[model samples]
Target chain A: MNIDSIKNGYVIDHITAGQAMNIYHFLNLDAMDCPIAIIKNASSKRMGKKDIIKIDIETDINLDILGFIDKDLTINVIKNGERIKKYNPELPATVKNIIKCKNPRCITSTEQELDHIFKLTDKKNNVYRCLYCEAKAGK
Target chain B: MRHLIDITDLSVEELDELLDLASDIAENPKKYQESCKHKKLASLFFEPSTRTRLSFEAAMFDLGGNVLTVSDANSSSASKGESVADTAKTVSCYADIIAMRHPKEGAPFVASKNASIPVINAGDGGHNHPTQTLTDLLTIKREKGRLDNLTVGFCGDLKFGRTVHSLIDALSRYTNIKFVLISPEELKLPSYVKKDVLAANNLEYVQTADLEEVIPQLDILYMTRVQRERFFNEEDYLRLKDSYILTPEKLKKAKEDLAILHPLPRVNEISVAIDEDPRACYFKQVLNGKFVRMALILTLLKEAGTL
Candidate 1:
């Protein structure tokens, strides 16, 4: 398989196997007009198998959504066909409009214009609770 | 700028201060009778409420403050599609403080953010009702003469009982407090509350299905009604509503000094036979609700420069 390296883009690597699709959808990669490649179950030395996403455009990505999805995934900034920088996304204290509160009793459920917000309650367990009802965010 | 949205919003020191103020009011009512004179309280109830709304109005009345009430959503501008923020802002112009109760959880939180005057969450679905917790605290303090070094048993629908959660959060701040949570398996206290409020605070608590077995050790037994409004299925509500009926027989094993507390408008979870018992402090809890609310109104009004 010969996949062309991007000149100026991002390579989202070290994604847990079978999670590239989740990242792609959450990051709204499907809406992007640039060239993109999602390599699933790629061979890796550290991980048994990993998924990687290569994007061919310079655009701002929502790291909060990405980190909420999987914090272990590394974001590689590529410039002129060379990796310029790489870093891990940090878990946000709070995220807005990333996910809707599922609890029917939550205020956000009735008020259509209200922003759906969730706060990180348990960092170790990656638990996010709705800011309105305190209901645990569903997967 | 100050709002009473959750019980944890007030610290132990603030709670003690409020208790002291409430106690002072109870002892010397004449001294604080006109403290809130010329001030007004707006009671906005988006849902139907009897005790909380009336108590808040009664509290303001006791302080010589007038009250403006919007008893239900249908009778208010909310029926004409006004948002909570707008209603709060509009009410702020007419009153010194606002007490709100909405069926949707966190509605008062939104009101607090938008309202210029201080806001109090009377009740918001199965969420925090800080005033109720304050009332419970005063009751416990009066009955036991202290807040700490006690075994408290919370009985009945702990899952949907916002009062139980708020009281637990409030009491967790005190030292030497142990909790005995008595509820049916299906209606047990939420794990997040246990993990965040109990385990996070390093408080000790035991969960059990049997109330009689743990009665003798309790310094306080907080009984909660299985709320039909909280349940989506009528069958589930009916099945669990009668789960923990505190009869005279059930109280036989309870400690002589045990303080029985309930956030009332009861649906037979507590028998009428037990009302005459010396241990029953639920009625006193209702009266405390008014006094503590008086203290709360004074505190918020003073802080807001409205008093």
Candidate 2:
């Protein structure tokens, strides 16, 4: 399976295995007209197996969602078929509308228009809690 | 300048100050009687809450302030589809401070974001009841004489009891505080709370099915009602309803000085017979609720430059 490398685009690498679909959905990659390739269970030296997403366009990616989904993920900017910049996404201090609060009694549940915001309460444990209901964000 | 959306919103120093103010008010009510003489409190209760709503109103009235109340959403413009933000903005225009009780967890937060005044979360769903936690703190301090180095036992529905969770969160910050969680398997404290608040803080806690087993070891016994509303299946609620009823027989093993606290409106979790016991402090908790509210109001008003 030889997928042509993009001349100028972003390669989101080191996604946890089986999480490419989640990233795809979360980033709304399907809505984009640009060509995108999701390689699942790809061989990796650091990670036993990982997923990589390649977007064939210089789209403004939401690094917060990428970091929240997989903290170890690396984003590579490819220019003229060569990697120009390689950096890891930082976990955002606060995230909005990325994940819904599951607590039934949370105000976000009742008020549909409100953004589902979560705060990174415990950085060491990678724990996020809903800003409204104080419910821990589920994996 | 700030809102009391969660118990953590108030720092340890702030909490101590509030507790001190509450103690002062309890001892000498006349000194702070006119604290909010020309102020107004908007009681925007989007849900049905008898105790919390009344406590806020009573506190404001005691402070020589008038209260503008909307007891339920049906009675307010909310029935006509007014958003919480809009309601908060409108209420802030009429009142100096707002005490909002909404069935939604983050409703008070929304109100606080939109309002110009301080927003007190009277009770927001099962997420938080910071004022109740404040009352519990004051009660613990008044009863135990210290918040640290005490083994507190929380009995009954720990999972759905917002007060129990809030108190546990508050107590976890103090030194040498151990928790003896007594509840049935169905009503055990939520794993998130156990993990986030207890484990993360490295706080000592033990889960037990028998309240009797842990009674003698506790310096404080916080009782909670097994709310029928929280359960989806009535049969499960019925089975676990009487799991930890604190009768005199059960209290035999408890310490003589054990401060039995309950965020009241109790229903059989604590036997009426134990009410005569000197350890019973739920009624005192109710009065403390008012005092704490008064303290909170004064502090918030002062912070907002309204007083």
Q: TM-score: which candidate is best?
A: 1
> Tens-digit lDDT track for model 2 on B1-307?
7789889998898899999999999999999888899899999888888999999999999999999999968889989988898899998889999999988888999999999999998887767889999999999998888889999999988988888988999999999999999998878999988987999899999999988888999999999888788788999888877767889998999899999999988878889999999999999999999999999999999988887
Listed for every candidate in order, the interface RMSD values in angstroms are 0.8, 1.0
Q: After superposition, how far is residue B99 of candidate 2 from its true place, in Å?
A: 0.3
Q: Which 10 consecutive residues of model 2 chain A have the lowest summed lDDT?
A: A58-67
lDDT of 1 at A9: 91
**Least well predicted 10-residue stretch by lDDT in candidate 1 chain A:** A58-67
CAPRI quality level assigned to candidate 1 from its DockQ score: medium
Question: What are the per-model DockQ values?
Answer: 0.72, 0.76
Tell me the tens digit of each residue's lDDT in model 1 across B107-172: 999999899999999989977788989999999998898999999999998887778888898899
Off by over 4 Å in 1: A30-33, A41-49, A58-64, B226-243
